[model samples]
Target: MCRLALKTANEPFSPYEVLQAMEAMKEGYDGSGLGLLLRGMEFEDFKYNPRFPILSGIAHSRKAEQRMDEYMDDRGYELKYDHRFAMNPEKMSGKMRYRYFLRAYRMPPAFKDRPQEEREEEMLRTRLDLRRIGEENNGDLTVFSFYPDVAMIKEVGWPMEIGEALCLWDGQIKSRVCMAQGRQNTNYGINLYACHPFFIQGIATMTNGENTAFVPIRDWLLGKNIPGYIGYQSDSEVFAHILHYTLRQLKLPLQAYKHIITPLSSRELETHPQGDFLRGLREVCRRLIIDGPNAVIGTLPDETCMLVMDQKKMRPATVGGRDGAWAIASELCGVDAMVPDRDPAFDFQPMREHTVIIPPDRKELQIWSQHDQLPLPQAA
Candidate 1:
């Protein structure tokens, strides 16, 4: 199982802190890779350029570097900021080298003033197209994400070394929300894109256990006419796509996702207070059911984050935070690292079959039981 730690606050928050938490619990993962996604991002220069899409990834060679610049320009994305990372070479010498670059781009002129939703859809498709090009061109480029207010930083190394190499140990990036995952998967290749904290169209998720139902989930998602669904490098990526489908495509409520992915059982539904509606949903969307002992933590486009445990709660997750900040991690130790001196009254671990909704500021924590959610009463 991998380890995940998330920190979100009302004010500017640094993801470097989350990396520090992962470092404290480094013993759990081999540290083959690390993935970080930050929303409501903060950087000295990026502060003034809030509307541009921040594209961050690796350029494997000089040719790849030239291609990236050309692709962005030819596509009408004005390159506003291009910053290469400064790695601590002393710490990374002799290690497999991956060059990191962050480029902020103004949307193509045609996209300006379009409805917010349409612009988001356009940028998302563009990002996916760029990633596909990278894949087809032999991995010369890896475009992480192209969205406003979100920035991605990923690397292959032990948590501590990766943090140090990127100077995260001293906190160089800040955001209202940030998540870091110590990728430890026994079943997959060590691909960087396969790392946790998977993202698509503003929805992101990272899990801490195996997804036994991954095959069926991926098969179903691939059938959907969605562009961003192509990169299922990690089985867990479906969790993020399924979320996008449910909330964006189908236009369902947030809680409805819990039912679709981990719906109530037939036996339980028969007696469930929300029986009638639950039965209908199960009949229509049973393929979305996820069978697992996994714990999933994710963030919504609205800046709300969620922590959910499978009925078994086989994987561990803890909750902690103070008035302005909130955190959820595979272990409480990580949470403790975020809000070191928290109010004891606000700290607690969620039980099995539970879901916790934490806002961007993490000002309040809401818990819902899977089997206990009563469907809306049917009208006459």
Candidate 2:
């Protein structure tokens, strides 16, 4: 199992803070890599830019940078501003470490006034094509995320060291919501691409346990016409894919995702008041059911964030914080690292077969069990 921690708030918070939280649970992971996805950014130049795709990625060599520019222009993307990472790490030596590059682009003017859905599809498709191009060419590049306000940084190193080297406390970078992971090499060899906190479009996810159900899930996603579902370096990446397929492709709600991956038996489903309604959902998405010891936390496209565990509850997770900010972690100490003085009296563990949902704007955390997840009908 790896260490997973996600911190989200109404105001911008540093990813390094979450990295420190992952460090607090260092006993669980060896720290082969660190991955961070930040949303609702406050970067000085990027924060004020008009609506456009802001791409953040890793370029292994000089050739990779040139390759990216050519590919983007060839694909009808106009380069707006290419802002290089500004970091001068004193503790580390040798060629500025890994450069986290950000480039803002204007969609071809022709795409203007198109249905919102078409624009989203094209953005995701082009990003996927770029990743494939980068990987096949002599240059090795992985564009972590390509949404308007989201920025991601991933690398091969200790989480705390990477965080400190990047200077997360610095004012230049920050986000209102961040999904972060510290990789502990277990089932596969270490590769920066295999790191956690996988992102697709606006959806991002990190898991603390293995996904035994990954193969079937992968196969199902591949069946779709989707192009971005190419890499599966880490089995947990499928969890992020599952979220994308359910919401983006199938057009379901976030709670429906928890139902897809962690469904209850028919008899158990009947216990909920909306068993009849849930039955329809179960029948349609049964193939998406997961079989494993896993706990997942993620942000949906709508900004509604969630934390859930498999029916077995083999994984450990704790949720704690006050209104306006919340932290989810594989262990209690991880949460403590983010919100130091959070009311201990207010903290609680999400039981097996349940999910904790924090609405897009509200600070309160709500629960939806495997039984009856839908809101109750209003009084007549």
lDDT of 1 by residue, 180-288 (tens): 8998867788888988888888889988888889998899888877778877778888888888887889777667778888877789888877788878877787888
For residues 123-142, write the lDDT of model 2, one tens digit per residue.
Answer: 88887877888779754777
Give the 10-residue window scoring lowest on summed lDDT in candidate 2: 90-99
Model 1 quality (TM-score): 0.94
Q: Number of the top candidate by lDDT?
A: 1
TM-score of each: 0.94, 0.92
Model 1, position 70, has a per-residue lDDT of 85
Clashing pairs in 1: 274-375
The Cα local distance difference test for each model comes to: 0.80, 0.78
For every model in order, what is the number of clashing pairs?
Answer: 1, 0
